[model samples]
Target: MTPLGPLLLLGFISGHLTLTRSAKILTVVLVGGSHYLLFDEISHILHESGHNVSMLVQLGNPRIKGVNYTGRNNSYRVISWSANEEYISSFNSWFLEQQKSFFEGSESLSTFLKFMGHLALQCELILGDTSLMDSLTAEQFDIVLIDAFNPCSFLVAEKLRARFLAVHVSNFWSWYLAGLPSPISYVPAARSMLSDRMGFWERLKNSAMFLGSWLTERMLYSQFDHTIRKCFPPGSQPVLSELYLKAELSIYNTDFTLDFPRPLLPNVVYVGGLLSKPARPLPQDLEDIILTAGDEGFIVVTFGSMLASVNLPVVLEQINAAFSQLPQLVIWRHLHTHWPSGVLPAQNVKLVDWLPQNDLLGHPKTRLLVTHGGLNSLMEAVYHGVPVIGIPLFGDQFDNMVRAEAKGFGLTVQVNQLQALGNAMATVIEDKRYKASALTLSHIHRSHPFPPRQRLVQWVDHIVQHGGRHLRPFGLDQPWYQQYLLDIILFSLAIVSLAVYIVTHLLKFAVGYLCSGGKLKVA
Candidate 1:
């Protein structure tokens, strides 16, 4: 062949390889709101990378109804299974009650357990739909990425016979699932509300919290056993805990700069700020408000999407009163229709049904953030160098706020202490140190050798291209007893006990012989 012919052949072979390299990826989205949005961002990233991505969406939460879970202009395929209206209503009722209980400080362990039961029932609904499962299986996906909150996703991945990775919407729980070492000495347990710097009593409490979390997870997983058996053949049912360990990768939506230092395995990746990007221009109305604020700038207040429908009249009154005391314009994310009957927002406070949170946070005129301490919000605040006043409600919110406070960029007040909200906001805004610390963190988060999105995409590509088995530690396959070296400890204890017994008897014989004047005594 001529030189030009060889070049043409090489180009054709390269194109063929590129076409063959694209993998078919399936993302399981079980919950709605921010959880759904996180998965959507992941699917979009993969789709942009030339992978054929499909999303399996289960509309389990009625609160997220009518919103486009997927972006308006997207190329990825979506397969959705929405629950019946009756189920949706029941879920919505339970969710509102749960929110009320949390705000009232009346939520208990039993309530959380009931929520787990709801998850199991949702899983049953998903698996019982034979046509949906058949359609998913027909796709023959190369890999599955699941939201780690629901154990049912593990079962779904099992049913599809695909290797899977877990995407934890927060920084904590997935550590346990990945079997990552979490020494209670420094790494605080999930939702324990303790920071890495723990005193003696705090350490004890942290350890207890770890035990409680482990028990809670076991109880949570046990609720799904019946569903597993009902859905799978007798011998083929997947063990929920085992499925957790089988994950090829555990991707946490947290960054080390924002999270406390902790040990992580090779398969664990932190992609905290994947959703963060450069700020876009705000709408004209919002821009006008920003311009009117002048030297004071504005404060952004949002309690996250889950709490959008929940109205706490007492808390609302306190917050409204607090916002009235501030000089800065308060851009609060609360439905005007759901505003408490008698509580009136101050003239400086702007109440809107919806606001572009990221854009507002990134705006130069934005001074402070009043948040529910969700990880996503915290990450965005850190990304934009904005200080925060966290009013943590539930789940990992408390812990996320603790991390922010520990990092010196924020302070937290309980829901009951809503009166302190204004003071905390004032402190964060007036204290130059808080702003300096936040800017430092933002720089560190942005200055990492690789950005979060790139890390997520590269690690995922690596796992899909070469498989993640080699990256997994051998200890994950070992039994719990072996993992803790319990057998070795037992053997060592036995040997010591036997030696002690022999030495004691010999000492007795020697003493008896000496007391008997060297005479032997017959038994």
Candidate 2:
């Protein structure tokens, strides 16, 4: 092929050929931690493309946002993920196994009070500090596209009454943002049944996740309602439920190419792979190290931002015991200084504070990765054709790992059990099936034309240009229990019981009166 052919292909992928103008859209992006990164990154691209974007960074510290929207320079900003202030250790409690936290704690009265307090703090911090409320009312945004975690967006959305679009970082949170709560954060279940191919137990596992999430979120929202009621006089809560329910449309940060049987809603859009930015140059030493590994391939181990350097004592020892003997080079990320005793670092065992992940994964010497099963890491592996050995800690990690395992992409390690971790990783390293599966998914993940950013930018433009209100779910107009209908059935049954009782009493009275002067006696 001529050089012109390569240039044309590059043009197509880079979106230099078919780029469109972005709308001047003001959006309240509610990022719930790193989960919001993909949407933020892509939407930023849209901002650069030609639209105006205001990012509400509800979760993460400011990283250099990926790119500007197509025609417009990106104007990225942060918003609080929730309408509540979360201090250190406050957010950590979500990883609590029993599913109990301030949001789901035993102190009903206290939890209620704190959530209310948190809401005020949230309003003051998220709205007041961020100047979100003013921006909403003054800037008069056409739409509000929020991350799954950003409850603050609901209030601003109500104030602005803009059209709302929900951007789900993944399926698990999508369930909650979709008004169907979930306990597992990593596993994004579909809205429909094609996902049932994972079988009954898997589905049951998903249901359990929903149960946990439902119970917890219900508590917080209820508390949030009480707090909102307190903050404003009667009739001024600004449609708090709307943010949770009124997403005109949803952008899923998942590639359908990888997650098959992806159940979609009419309002939901699949805009995955929006965060793929081509990597920078790799260091010479790193390239040489990778080349040295050869056919045996190398392993990249990273635990995402949330649970870095947890108190898990056994993890280090087990990793050392396993990696020391292996021919492949091992790259591990341990943020803390503490290392397990008696473990000498072997030539193949490499420790890093951090490594250029995308670069290494794309390298010829790379083969496998050992991660905590973060969606970000999972996407990275699939995109780079590197299999994983997952050590799932909590949230959606377990579910994500399970899906990867099902897809033959990698093995999973139990967080606490070192034996399980070692065994699971062995399978990943020894098995070529894992590598093959990962490569297939990589091809699928990248097959989409125009990076995810282009799609997101277009949608943002559409919402802004059309007025975002039209992008909402008709379902949100219904009340909570009414949407589920459990209360309606119960209420109907109660009415039937009352009618039955009245008829029975009247009939008995008539029968007695006909028989004996209409007088009735108590038993």
Candidate 3:
């Protein structure tokens, strides 16, 4: 009871903010592939506000060859960290090999371990180098913007003595693992393919998956903590959970308009399209092709960076077949070097190694997007009012596509069900409701009082100016068993058991006394 009193008081008052002036920001983006877009935009925003901004990033990772920065602002200086190219290539190979296993639910425990180990090693490479760590520590950043996916970055924040910490998460479900309320009754796990509205059986499955996912996250955190501890002096480093719980705010690449309505903490901000910009005019070749398609607009297809390694000939044939049946011109962003010899592309179809995804989605002639349901692509689609045919391959993609379908903005078909893709495409194209719903959501997405970038900057500045010490939930201080009131449950059970035992014994004594009295009367 005494412990709870302080917790309640602290939590009640923690929501209050102590506003201060702006701050010098340091952005740490460890996932340096396509994910760099998130940080680049953030750094640009901070830089625009006359704040001193510096970045620590891995230059080894690139989503598209020859194009490293989508909108790299020259104002912010970058500290590049390089890794062995061969090693990075091998790591990507391992990731590619596991995609099928991940989708099939057959991914081995070793695969998961190796992946985390790889991230840990990447951290080691940076933190292990004395000169780099020293340089970073000397920066004395006011605030550190870190990717939530890379828990190891917390050690850097600690070393730099950063005043405040904010996290950017590419996938939203991971936030649930950070001690937020995500009821299994309705909230779907990141990998879950189920919609928010579920039947009894589906609810049961969601609960089971929730428990499993939580356990897996705990294990991963343990690994990260163990690795991070080694980098710091003994007894000084905090565990991964502490770092997450201490975060003042989190910027999720998700919005309520595209997602099912659910409870969220005030500290959790949705700046889903912070990286999005006004669409640029299409490249001349693409413009020419798009213009030639008279009344029937064009379709854009892309599967994102990780899945770009797909070289399945049968899948290519299926895609080609579907495209041939449609009258609309198609711009397929295929990644493999050689086109499959088995199928001839339709006259209306064009293949490219890469495409400006956001720009294409924004084009007026583009009516539909065939995507893998990655969050970035979905956000872009929603921003542009473009409907989607999501063929989720793995990970949070399945969940993202499901939400899209539930929201009436898109439809989803299994990647293997290539035959049905054409029908799914036809249904979405012929149905005006999909486009109308997408446009509605786009309006909602854009209707925030403050633009996403401004909102992000303001929140970050708030945390920096005010220590944000109060934002920590009181539940974090309580023990997990106590937080769930398991102790109270046990105490109540004991009380009930004692009452039943006393009542039964008293009845037995009364019965025994009656028997004795009867015996005495008979005598």
- Most TM-score-accurate candidate: 1
Per-prediction TM-score, please?
A: 0.95, 0.71, 0.88
- lDDT score, residue 267, model 3? 68
TM-score of 2: 0.71
Write the residue-wise lDDT of candidate 3 on 1-523 in tens digits.
6989989887767643334344667888877544676777778888887678887887665544323224574778788887888988887777666764543435555677677777888887777788988887776777888877776677667666665465655556786535677877778876667878889999988888888887888876666665676677887877777777777777777788777777777667777787566799878987887888888999999877555556666777887889889989999986546566666777889887778888998888888999988888898898889999998765577888888998898999886677899999989999999999999988988887887888777877777776565676788668888989999999999999999999999998788779787453433
Candidate 1 minimal-lDDT segment of 10 residues: 63-72
Put the candidates in TM-score order, highest first: 1, 3, 2
Best by lDDT: 1
Tens-digit lDDT track of model 2 for 1-523:
9979999899887774233444435555543335554655655675667656666554433222222212223255443454334462463343332212211213243444454455445544554444546655676655666655545556656556566776666644445565542323334443222233546676676667556655666566665564456444576665455456567667776665556453455556777655454556777777676677778878887666433434344446666777776778887765435444455666787766557767777776776888877777777788888888886654556667767777888876664455565566667767888888888888877876766766776666665555445545555667767777979899999999999999999998789878876566667
- Per-residue lDDT over 101-179 for candidate 1, one digit per residue giving the tens place of the 0 to 100 score: 7877676778877888888888998999999999889989989999898888888899888899998998775578989
Q: Which structure is stronger by lDDT: 1 or 2?
A: 1
List clashing residue pairs in candidate 1: none
Off by over 4 Å in 2: 1-22, 26-33, 58-120, 128-132, 159-161, 179-195, 198-213, 230-233, 238-241, 260-262, 277-280, 309-313, 336-346, 449-451, 468-523
How does model 3 score by TM-score? 0.88
- How many angstroms is residue 476 displaced in model 1 relative to the true structure, after the best TM-score fit? 0.8
Instruction: Score candidate 1 by lDDT.
Output: 0.87
